[model samples]
Target: MPELTLEATSAIAVAFAAVMTVGFAARQQRWGPGLMVVGILGFLGIISFGIVTRL
Candidate 1:
């Protein structure tokens, strides 16, 4: 496997950080079922495949 460049790693890190930061807003609301399901799913999505998607 090819090693990740600084840019690539930064992209993933920034993406992950952005998602988590935004996810905080998903809390502190009348979420009712009040789950982080969407955030969790998005986080998982990034971790699993979002960063490496093809054009």
Candidate 2:
């Protein structure tokens, strides 16, 4: 199995951070579940990307 590259990890981390931040902000502003869904999907997508790329 190949080692996980820093570039790929960083991308996933950044995406996760962005999604969570937006989610928290939305929750604070009472934006409801729609925005929360966006954040959740974004987070899951990033996780999936990491798993698919990682060995």
Candidate 3:
């Protein structure tokens, strides 16, 4: 897969949050799953930022 640009990383984070919100509304899932997903995405974003700054 291609590497994600900063914009793509952030956009996906937002999109996942939105999807999770909708899922919550329907009582289809709990907070744990969404939290984990966003957590990992946020971590990646943070790591990328650090790498970019160091470059």
* Reference-based lDDT, each prediction: 0.58, 0.68, 0.66
Q: Can you give the lDDT of residue 16 in candidate 2?
A: 61
Runs of candidate 3 with Cα error greater than 4 angstroms are 28-55
Candidate 1 structure quality by residue, lDDT tens digits, 4-55:
5668756876766665566566656656223445546655765566456432
Model 3: lDDT equals 0.66
Candidate 3: worst-modelled 10 consecutive residues by lDDT = 20-29
For 1-55, candidate 3 gives per-residue lDDT tens digits of 3466789867877866675566556555566567556656766766686677677
How do these models rank on lDDT, best leading?
2, 3, 1
The regions of model 2 sitting more than 4 angstroms off are: 28-55
Instruction: Please give the TM-score that candidate 2 achieves against the real structure.
Output: 0.47
What TM-score does each of the candidates earn?
A: 0.48, 0.47, 0.45
For residue 9, model 2's alpha carbon misses the true position, in angstroms, by: 0.1
In model 3, what is the error at residue 35, expressed in angstroms?
A: 13
How accurate locally is residue 11 in candidate 3, as Cα lDDT from 0 to 100?
80
Q: What does candidate 1 score in Cα RMSD to the true structure?
A: 6.0
Give the Å error, residue 8, model 3. 0.5
